[model samples]
Target chain A: MSATLAVAAAQAKTKTSNYARIYWPFVVPAGLLVFAIIIAPWVFTLIMSVHEWKVGEDPAFVGLENYIRLFNDSRFQWAILRTVYFTTLAVLFPMVLGIAAAVCFHKNFPFRGLARTIFILPMMATPVAVALVWTMMFHPQLGVLNYLLTSIGLPASEWSYNAVSVIPTLVLVETWQWTPLVMLIVLGGLASLPQDPYEAAKLDGASSWQMFRHITLPLVWPHIIVALVIRTIDALKAFDTIFVISNGGPGTASETLNIFLYQTAFAYYNMGYASAITVVFFILIMLVSLVLFSARQKTTFQ
Target chain B: MKMRGLPGKIGFALSVFALISPAILVFLWMLSLAFKNEVDNTAFPPVFIPNPPTLDNFRAVFEKNNFFHYAWNSIIVSFTATGLALLLGVPAGFGIAKSKASKAAALIMIARVTPGLSYLIPLFLIFQWLGLTGTLTPIIITHLVITVPIVVWVMIGFFEGLPAELEEAALVDGATIWQAFRFVALPLARPGVTVAMILSFIFSWNNFIFGVVLAGRTTRTLPVAVYNVLTFEQISWGPLAAAALLVTAPVLLLTLLMQKEIVAGLTAGGVKGG
Candidate 1:
């Protein structure tokens, strides 16, 4: 009986090893690529951040100096504030519009499918191309947007060209592109909801707004949170559209942390400073993710 | 369900139309600007239609730049990156799914969450040192940073949804794990593969930041080329809109052709940033 028990243990070990041999071979290649391509560069960025390095100069170790300067820099402070400001507007507008759109489309209507397809087109088009076309449309004189505003008895205003309105204008473009993404996600959530509660609510003669608020919204809250998290991350790292439309123009009014980092690294060739900024930017993203995900967990339990 | 009157139905339709018309009009506006000549493009009333739409803008776009060359570059970069991503991600996804390795999946998510610039700055210096900048290789490799995670994440969900019985049957029938995967699992995963391939291709093709930094003048992709047009050509609305349209045309065509698959791919990873 003891020998039999020993044999059983040996067989279990071999079986596990065999499984490992099969699966590890499959996983290792991708793991290596992830490490080499994604992981290594981040490690390098972290290492570079501690030094006082520039393009065409020798790197000198200056632990925390770049970060020290970063916190004190007014421009960096404003960039952080602008990033938060832009991200809040970008995420909020889309969530509101997307939830509204998803709810509207959830009810049966003529050409609903066609409308969804049309709505997602902006999300599909390349950001650079979209930005260029929007820049054209946002033209103060000859652009269609101002023309429409004027024809509607509203005064034409500088869209992205003005300093004060630059971030909001950029957020408008961001909202236009991303609302469909949020809509689609929320639509998926809505489609999966059980019908019993909604049926009971209808039997109770609840108003549509009440039903949506109490039933649909709670049921779809997880999906909304997911969309919120995705949009926040995307908006935080928004580079292509802003780079094309304003490129942090009107004297850097639209320059978020991303644009500032890009200018520091590429335009100014301040690699060390940029690396420090990258570290901060990454931490900010992670922090937001943690907060949003905790909210997601709470929603899941309720 | 309560029956609606004709007035109610019409109102519903009109509201839906109002909701979607902005999306339609933006694309239509881009289209109008693309086909019109400079005169009509910048007209005071903002011409919604061209009385005599001409191909001159398209012709000028082609003439002013090496548009075909850039298009070819985009094709090469996008396809190779996506193909390589499939090669790496699909099997890894299968392995992780089969093993229930939640940790590995989380690692891939981390890669997706990290900003592109974080990887890009260091890679830029290294590529320059390795004398690999200005080549398609670095762009293709960096694009894997985008494409691989997408493929892996999508495939993990897909493989998890797949039943394990068939693979187990293959294994019991004197087949090795690889054989079971190749014959039973991969064949069953065609739809997932298609979705992953298309999404990865579209994303890689549409990427601007990678090409803007890594691609040289001769190796510029279409997005980067369109950007160059913006910077160099003084923003000629006719030609500029035409160029923008040209860059977006392939993606728009792909989206139209594969809308269902694209939507599935998107909502499949409903939690991730597209």
Candidate 2:
């Protein structure tokens, strides 16, 4: 027994030493890249927010000026309100539509797989491609959507060009592109459901609606939260679709914080101000994510 | 029973059709628009079926736009990024998983959650300083941000699920640790590798924000190229639709061909059983 134990200890010591050498080579580079790429940029944005500079000029330290300006600026406030509105509309519509679709196809039906695939097609397509297609379909005079509306006796509206319609139009396009993501989450949750409760409900002579209300809704709530949090984060950071479709529009009507930052940093060449906006945007995202995460934790605890 | 059965069947059919109709209609409309000429594209009523469909727009897209170049660029960037990501991420994932490094994993998640543009600008400045702004290197490296985490996260789940007994047995047979991983672990993880490849490729192909801000005219990607077409030309619905369709065609075909794999890739690490 002593001999066997000594041999095992030697093997264990060798294994531990081997693992130490093999592990650091993989961990260190990945760790450094993530830090430089993600975490450092965030810190840089925060630091740059307090400084003032144009593209070529040296950054002049102006403590609290940018934040002060941000608070007093009317356009910035308007952008915040508009972004909140856009995020709300964009997130809610997709959530409701995706849940509806998931519920519809939750059970085994003929061509169910095909139907699910088709629904997910939009999500898989490149966002730029989707935006370009919608841009054509939103043309004022000859676009298919306008023609359909006019044919149905509604007044034809300038979808993308008109200031009144651009934000909502962009929201609709976003919802159309993202609803499939929500459906996928919900479908995963639905599929993982235990069947005993469902079978019990059926034996109790409960209708489909009752079963859905009592069992499905409660069970899928976590999935719904997951979908909402993901969509909210994505929607809050929306840029590519809006950039392609409207370029933030005829006015600043469709401009979110991201668009604001892009235009300020690149187009206007005001890096300091753009950095300020980015810092604020980051904080906003973190706060929203934290709230959602805490709420989820509470529910899980219950 | 018969009366209820008929109603239930009809209700199920109607609901399923309703859920699916929007997507199918949009796809069909895109297809019809791709083949239609200008006159047919804007006829009095929107034609579901274009009378006498033509290939002129497709020809125009190919001939005028150098679309084949853009396609090649996309393939190169996506494949190279995916290849590099797998090389780096798989071993990283295995190390992290074995080490139980949740903090390191959370750091990766932080990278994933932060907005792309926030980091993109600073990186743009850095690339400008390095004089590598226009080349494919910047874009490919930038894309690693998207692809690596995906590969790493998926691979973590895969490696964790794997039995350690195989590697132990290989080690017991006098194999080196690297040999145990290379010979025993990698071959068994082929499905996860496939998932990583398909996903990383799809993401790198679809990504537009980095390409737009970083890429110059010579190195423009398909998504950026398509956006330029929208902004540059007169809004000719026919040619624009044709361009959109042409840009989407390769990816659409890929998704269709690898539908099951793509689905598996997206759902990886999301569900427990999956």
Candidate 3:
């Protein structure tokens, strides 16, 4: 009996070990590729940030100079401020609009599914494509927006050309493109909500506003926070659309940190300065994410 | 909860329309503009109805531009990247899931969050060193950065949700581990695979940043090609809109057709519902 039991245990171990061994070869190459492509680049960026180099020039060590210079750079400051401004507007508008849309579409009605699909179209469309479309739409002359304004007897404005208007217009474009993503996240939250509290609220003769304020708000708070955080990070690192639409615009008026960094690195071949900007950008994103995560934890715990 | 009745129904319809009309209006305007002629496109009143609708813009896109080449490039890059991502990601996901490697997944997310350009510059250097710059190979490999994590993260949830009993049973039937996974595990994970495929395709197809930086004239994807028209043209609204629409139309159609599938794909593992 003892001998038989030992043999069975050995057989089981051999079978499980064989399975593990078979899968390891497949896992390593793919796993390494991800690590190489994704993780390695960030490390490379960090190393490159400290080294003073132009394209085709040997990188020289410039300890803390890039970092020090970043603090005093007015353009970098402006880019940071502009990024914050854009992120603030982008986050705030989308949160309000997304929540409103989610609330409106939370229940079954005619074309709710179709409405949801239409809403998400912007999210699915290429950022560059959307930027192109909006560029034409927001044209100062011969564009639909100006055309509409003039037809309605309001004076037409140069939306994209004006320095002050450029950032806001970019913000508007970002809002249009991304509000649907926030809406979708919140919609998922709303749909997953238990029906009992809502039923109880109705039984107590609560108004829709009251129910939303007291019940729905608290329940979907996590989703709201997630959407905000994700959108914040995305807005902070806003590129592609802004790049295509404005190319940092009529005299760097619409430049964000990413564009700033891109120009600093690729266009100017100032890798050290770009790297310094990137490190700062990375910190900003991490800080925002940390705050949001902590806030979410507190809300969920409560 | 019970339905609120007639007044409620009326209010709901109005609210829904109000919520969705802006997006619908924008799309409709784009569609109309795409079909309008140059004369009507910039008409003073901004013609909503293209009275003499024409396919001139699309024709212009096809005739003057290398639309077919760009489209083919996009298709090959997106599919190849997605395909490679799947081959790599599924196993990684299974391994990560089985090992419960949340840290590995978080590391992948960090990569996802970092702006593509940060890496693109250095990668460009590397590609140049390898003499592979301006090739589809670099784009496909770079796109894996976008596609792989999405596949792995999504599939992690899928693998976790799956029952282990079937695989165990296959093992009990004296099949090798590879055989069990090949014949049993993968076939059962069709939904997850589909979700991965759709998302990977969308992301890969719509990727503009990589194409812009990496692609040469001969190797340009649709977005890059469309962008070229914008820079190259003398700000001609008609052809530009036409070109933009032509580039966007296939994606738009694919999106509409796969709306249900795409939604399911995106929201999968993130949320729980059908």
**Global CA lDDT computed for model 1:** 0.87
Residue pairs with colliding backbones in model 1 are none
B1-274 in candidate 2: lDDT tens per residue?
1115878889878887877676676677887888988888878667779778988878778877778888888888889988988888888888887677777887777666677888887777778878997799898888888888888888887888899899989988999777877899889888888877777777788999888888898788888887875558646666767777877777777777787776666654431100
Per-residue lDDT of candidate 1, residues A1-302 (tens digit)? 99999999998987887655568788889999999998899899999999999988998999999999999999999999999999999999999989988887778766666678888888888889989989998999998999999999999989999998889999999999989889889988998999899789888998777877788888888888988888888888988999999999899899999889989998898999999999999999999999999989875623
Compared with the true structure, model 1 gives a TM-score of: 0.96
Q: Report fnat for all candidates as fractions from 0 to 1.
A: 0.68, 0.48, 0.49
Q: List the residue pairs that clash in candidate 2.
A: none
Which lDDT values do the candidates have, in the order given? Answer: 0.87, 0.80, 0.80
Tens-digit lDDT track of model 1 for B6-116? 897777777778777877888888889989988888789888897799889899888877889999999999999999999999999999988888999989988767778
Identify the runs in model 1 with alpha carbons over 4 angstroms from their true place. Answer: A11-21, A299-302, B1-3, B271-274
As for DockQ, the candidate ahead, 2 or 3, is 3
Residue pairs in candidate 3 whose N, alpha carbon or C atoms collide under 3 angstroms: none
Candidate number achieving the greatest TM-score relative to the actual structure:
1
Q: What RMSD value applies to candidate 3?
A: 3.2
Estimate, for each residue in B29-60, the C-alpha lDDT of model 3 and write its tens digit.
77777788888888876888887888887777
CAPRI-wise, candidate 3 is: medium
- Which portions of model 2 show Cα errors greater than 4 Å? A1-24, A300-302, B1-4, B269-274
